[model samples]
Target: MMKVMVMVKATAGSEAGVMPTNELMEAMGSFNEELVKAGIMESGDGLKPSNEGYRVRFSGSKRSVIQGPFVETNELVAGYWVWNVSSMEEALEWVKKCPNPMFEDSDIEIRPFYSMEDFADVDTSGEFRAQEDALRHTLSLQKASLNNYLFFSGRCEEALNYYVQHVGAKIDLLMRFSDSPEPIPEDMLAAGFEDKVMHCEFTLGGAKVFASDGCNDGTTLSGFSLALTVATAQDAQRVFAALSENGQVTMPLAETFWSPLYGQVTDQFGMAWMVMLPAT
Candidate 1:
């Protein structure tokens, strides 16, 4: 419920460009991973040596600039993390578990961030709080999103099940022609296609995609292929096999100039997919 900034103080050795050893780096990576898995880590980063930085000082109507290699080495921050913890005690406990961040002895300081509630006495009109809320809303709106929609001639239900079984897609929503409050035109569906899927949403590879059985006009998916990127060659081969079964493989899975494993396949439902491991 409380946000805290944890700062790693720069050490003489760190300021002298002494880098962390592989073992220490691994330990820090593991520690950060643990923090993320616990959902307390908001953001963190290590800073470059202060010698490469600058400072700006301002007076009533004057400004002065100072280049760094700032003499007070101990006062410089080497890195910092913004974490949300239940209490200062929790933050202290987590900090105690962190590895020494520098080659030499170093200090880590934890300070709580000022919450909106702390300003209640100053902002009697609630103006600052309203502005903060509006900025937060704008930040949320700036998050981008994209979704893919697929149409099947009349096999959407079967295709959804096929995807769920083969590629682990999770169907979040589904509606049939009969589920519509307004009657579906007779010509819109072939004889037994009335029970087919009208619309459904599913997630594959962490992306939401839409699927539906459109009017039986014989149209099929074309022009675009869903790109399924996996982590390793083994996964790429396995998914390619599952998707290409009974379908044609435009490009057999093999080592490519771009990827370690790559291929193209048109699934049995006539949907094309590009299966590959991400290029290093």
Candidate 2:
């Protein structure tokens, strides 16, 4: 496995402006999604314009600093990606598919990273390689994150099924008020709500969310909203429309400064939702 750094050169327009158009941002996001699904991209990010950063130069023991809005835009990197590929050739093919990152003429350069193997002849003892292997594990796959918890008013099962069918969620675990091993208080559950969801956990987009049926009093959800990060603009559009059907549209899904398809809607059950293409 070869690791390469793909450097994106700054463009004139990007230096002057802070944001990219929604279409261009969405195109870039789609490209990033492809890279992530393929496991080619390790990490990537765009930079603030030069003025927000500085450069330091060293000569012998002395150092000097220079600040941005640097004179040469061509030499400044607007963004970069660290990709893992089989070879430089494979890396090039992936870069070729990237959208015009700056919404104008820009360039990307791919350079290989040095692996522990490259130091085999000089290090001889292999101590550095062992340390690297251990350190890298700290950055390995993490546990599933639980993001949001919802308490429903006896309609938990109905909302749970709606998410499972429409929002691509899978029930990981579920317990009914009747399924409780410990005697659940009658007041804890509403009358005729013995089969209502007592506690439920579900997975959506590899993240977990929790829900439960509590005190059956037609509760109103307020203050916070759930955000779904999808892979494509088409999916965002479709989901926004689906969530808005027979529901309230607080903010119509449209181009936003931060996202390609950004919107806020309340589902039929009054759960607020913000849907958008993944951030680039």
Candidate 3:
């Protein structure tokens, strides 16, 4: 049997210490019942708000308290279930059948648990698994694994500046059309677009983002939006407001069913954005 953890995300309502509605509770209870009947759910429970928790930071041989109200809600554990499944694919199938855990858009992440068998190939002597596992625990931490990409027009440089100054985006790598090893297409060169941005990579609050100037044509976009997760209500509102300048507000920043501060906007560069404080 394979063991996996299915983690539920916290939302704005849950963070403010709001209890789930009876309907939501009933739905979740029914879902949990199904999992139990299938013998797939080993254990599960929700958690109190982050404010009720505390964190410890390590600096070499010393440790310090960071207190509650931690940032990175996306990285926080709201609720979780330990399941005995045959494979990752099987766990996902079960997750899909679960009720919507929240009243709004939410996410559930699954991760496999380490087992002694995992080390069998390393030495064929399973006795060392326990020691290695314990020693490795002192040096491991979660990491960033997702990013967004954007394709823009000739104004990519301007858009990059706007994000840098307003939303705290840091440019990591940028290459202009002239910097490319390949010559600019004859058609584009004749169109006076040789100076356009060719490619750029940046980080918004440590999340990777990619952008490029696609032929320098005016942007016409749809079907996807960039989501920014902030740490606090104050930062959410502040950043949302800053991004709204000279842009259209699709949704005004406000406390929503899912997030502490949530809103959507289409910036001057014609890109849609979802600025939010991580749910809960």
| Candidate 2 lDDT over residue span 132-176, tens digit each | 765553332122121466777767888888998999999999988
Model 1, 112-182: lDDT tens digits are: 99988999999999999989875764454344233456778787887789999999999999988888767
Identify the runs in model 1 with alpha carbons over 4 angstroms from their true place: 148-280
How much lDDT does each candidate structure score? Answer: 0.82, 0.78, 0.76
TM-score for each candidate, following the candidate numbering: 0.59, 0.51, 0.45
- Compare the candidates by TM-score and give the number of the best one: 1
Q: Which has the higher TM-score value, candidate number 1 or candidate number 2?
A: 1
RMSD of each: 15.7, 16.0, 22.8
Roughly what TM-score does model 3 have, to 2 decimal places?
0.45
Q: Give the lDDT ranking, best first.
A: 1, 2, 3
| Steric overlap count per candidate | 0, 0, 1
Q: Between candidates 1 and 2, which one is better according to lDDT? A: 1
Q: In lDDT terms, how accurate is model 3?
A: 0.76
